[model samples]
Target: MSVTRHKVWDPLVRIFHWSLVIAFAANALFTDPESNLHEWIGYVVVALIAIRILWGVVGTRYARFTSFPPSASGALGQLSDIATGRKRAHLGHTPLGAMMIYNLLLTMLAIGVSGYMMTTNAYWGVDWVEELHEIFVTWAEISIVLHIGAVIWESLRTGVNLPRAMVSGVKTVPEGIKIEP
Candidate 1:
C-alpha cells in the first residue's frame, strides 16, 4: 500500500461551499415575493458568488478551478464508471463533482443577476425579466437537487463520508491511491 498527503481544500473554499448552501436554502425559505428579505438575500448571493469566483482564480492549490474542473470527456468517463458500478475512491472532487461546482456557481450567478435586474426601475415590473428570474431560480433549484443526490450517491459508492470530508477537509482514501498535495 502507498500513501500520499494532499491538501484537499483550502479554508476559503470549504467555508464558501457550506455558507453558500446555507445562504441559498435560507434565501429560499425566508424570502417572499412581497418582502424586501428576498432582495436582500439575492444581494448576499451575489456577493458570495463574486467572492467565490475571485477565490477560484487566486486561491490555494485545491481551491483553484484549474485544480479539479475536469474536461467534458473526463466527466463522461466518471459517469460511465458510476453507471457500471466501477467507481473508485477519489481524494478530491470527482470529475462530475467538479463539473457540478461550476454548474452551481453559474446557476447562482444567473439567479443573482436576474434578481438584480428586477430591482432596477427599467427592469422592475418588466414581465420578461421577472419571468427570466423565475426560470433561473428553477434551474438553480434543480442543480441543488442534483448536487445533493450526487453527494449521497458518492458516499454510498465510495464508503467515504463526503459531508464529513467537506467539514474536516480530509478524506481517507483506501490503500494504493496517491493523493496530490
Candidate 2:
C-alpha cells in the first residue's frame, strides 16, 4: 500500500492531547484526593480543557470543531462500517471519535467543577458532592479506556497509527483508502 502523510494534528492540539492525558492519569492514579498536589493538578486539567475548548473554535483546519462535528448518524454509520468489515479512515476525527472527544471534554468539565466544589466550604464535607465527583472521575476513567481501545482498533483496521499521529501531528494514512472528510 502506498503511504501519504497528512498533517492532521497541529502542535497545540497534540500538546493539549498529551497534556490532558498526563494530567488525567496523574490525578486518577497517582495523586491523593485530599492533597494539595491533587487539587493543583485538577486545576491544571481544567485549564488545559478550557484552552482546548477555545482552540477548537479558532485552531487549524483539522483542529477546529467544525472539522469533526459530532453527529449521531455519522457515528452509527461508522459502526456500520466496522460491522460490515469496511475500512474507512477519517482525515481528522471520525464521527465516533468526535463524539468521544465531546464526551471527554464535558466529562472533564464535570470532574473539574465537581472537584472545585469539593474545595469550597459549601461543598466541603458534603457526601453527595464527593460521591458526584467520584462518579465523574469513574466515568472519565472508563471513557479514557474506551478511547484508547477505539484508537488502537481504528488504527489497526485502517492501517493508521493513531497514537503516533497524536504525538507527531501527522497521520500517515495508506494511499487509496476511503477517507471520510
| Candidate that scores best on TM-score | 2
lDDT of 2 by residue, 1-181 (tens): 7898888899999999999999999999998889999999999999999999999998898989998998999999999999999888898999999999999999999999999999999999999999999999999999999999999999999898999999888888888788777
RMSD of each: 2.4, 0.8
List per-prediction Cα lDDT, in the order shown.
0.78, 0.93
Name the regions of candidate 2 deviating beyond 4 angstroms: none
Task: Give the per-residue lDDT digits (tens) of candidate 1, residues 22-94.
Answer: 8888877766765788788778888988998898899876677877876798788778877887757666678
TM-score, predicted candidate 1 vs. hidden true structure: 0.89
Give residue 118's error in model 2 in angstroms. 0.6
Give lDDT: candidate 1, residue 6.
43
TM-score per model over all chains? 0.89, 0.98
lDDT of 1 at 64: 76
**Clash pairs for candidate 1:** none
